[model samples]
Target: MILDRQLLLSNAQPITATAVSTNTIDLAIARDIGIGDNLELFIKVIAAFAGGTSVQFAFITSANADLSSATVIVQTPAIPTASLVAGSEWLRVQVPALSQAAAMQRYIGVSYTVVGTFTGGTVTAGLALDREGTAYYPSGLNSGGF
Candidate 1:
């Protein structure tokens, strides 16, 4: 995939898992991003004050910058089987292309959330990958247009 890793957020503040205001992540998608490509996400846990907490990640798509009209695209299946281990914990996720559905309007992003009690976890940085993002045809073309 032709993608680049870009930082979405770097929080010195601890994330409150229950609140979207604290745990949500949003990224701006380039207008020319390819429909065949997708934006991948990563959440690297810098610290978790409490261990053994199950966390989940969710993906959302939106047309607005504030993520007001957002739709949950990839619903986190369930709380992760494993528990947080401070520096050892990291997650990777991706959003699927709209495919036959109409082209993505303007923006795309993902978030990390947990169902149960979560307190004092710091995410050093949230990174994203926009596959084939360098150009609509990031993969380049074959000779003779074949």
Candidate 2:
């Protein structure tokens, strides 16, 4: 999957606490982004997470660039820390289609809410043209290709 830098929401951002994404996609600036083709948001664990009971990832949109008072379009269930291994794909979902996107606000971004203490974790999130995510299997099980 090709990731465009301009569509990036978070780039290897460390998550020690609850926080908004480092960047946002301004729909006014990139009006054509999700118009013609479907785009997917990819959130990957760049570093092993430790000390957090669970974490939830939210996809939000708002009129302000700061993302305050935003509407959450979609979100992940609280993911247990035990499952947050490095290189894991936390969330991958398609961006809204043109009709839906048009009715929303102008800014899009991600939010990380950690339940309990989050001592260590790094994540990278962005919009991509393809899913291209890895499929993990239990030990001793191999599907020729994923």
Candidate 3:
């Protein structure tokens, strides 16, 4: 069987607080899925600042109301680790392929942390997804014969 998936930007709030610190944002989705399902996540980040800054991205999974137990599935490309000139948008990072095993049920989310020094700034992030199934069968001449 094949499955189609889509990831909508559920949140896009501006960053109000200032000061050098790490901020984590989380996005979650719940649905019934099976094992051997392939999942791909895409992310786009826009930075609006005048000074240098760094950001870290990660993908995680969790159960209903149990975010504390969330597990990290993948970490985004290494931090830019340089001066992010004003009005800079980084390329979208494509998360590594993730397979849903029998242990996983309903719940997937993306989390990220933005850390840097600045007077004040705003950053925006978004996510997209694609999915497929993994199943194979060998050619056969008949139901009971090879």
Q: Specify the highest-lDDT model's number.
A: 2
Model 1 superposed RMSD (Cα): 9.7
Pick by TM-score: 1 or 2, better one: 2
Q: Which of 2 and 3 is the better model by lDDT?
A: 2
**Model 1 lDDT tens row, 22-55:** 3333334334434455555555567754642566
Q: What is the TM-score of each predicted model, taking all chains together? A: 0.52, 0.85, 0.45
Q: Which residue pairs does candidate 2 place in steric collision?
A: none
What tens-digit string does per-residue lDDT give for candidate 3 at 24-106? Answer: 22223333332243434433334444343555555555663333466666665645435343444443455443343443434
In model 3, which regions exceed 4 Å deviation?
1-6, 15-39, 47-52, 81-99, 102-105, 117-146
The global C-alpha lDDT for each of the candidates, from Candidate 1 onward, is: 0.50, 0.87, 0.42
Q: For candidate 1, what is the TM-score?
A: 0.52
Worst 10 residues of 2 by lDDT: 95-104
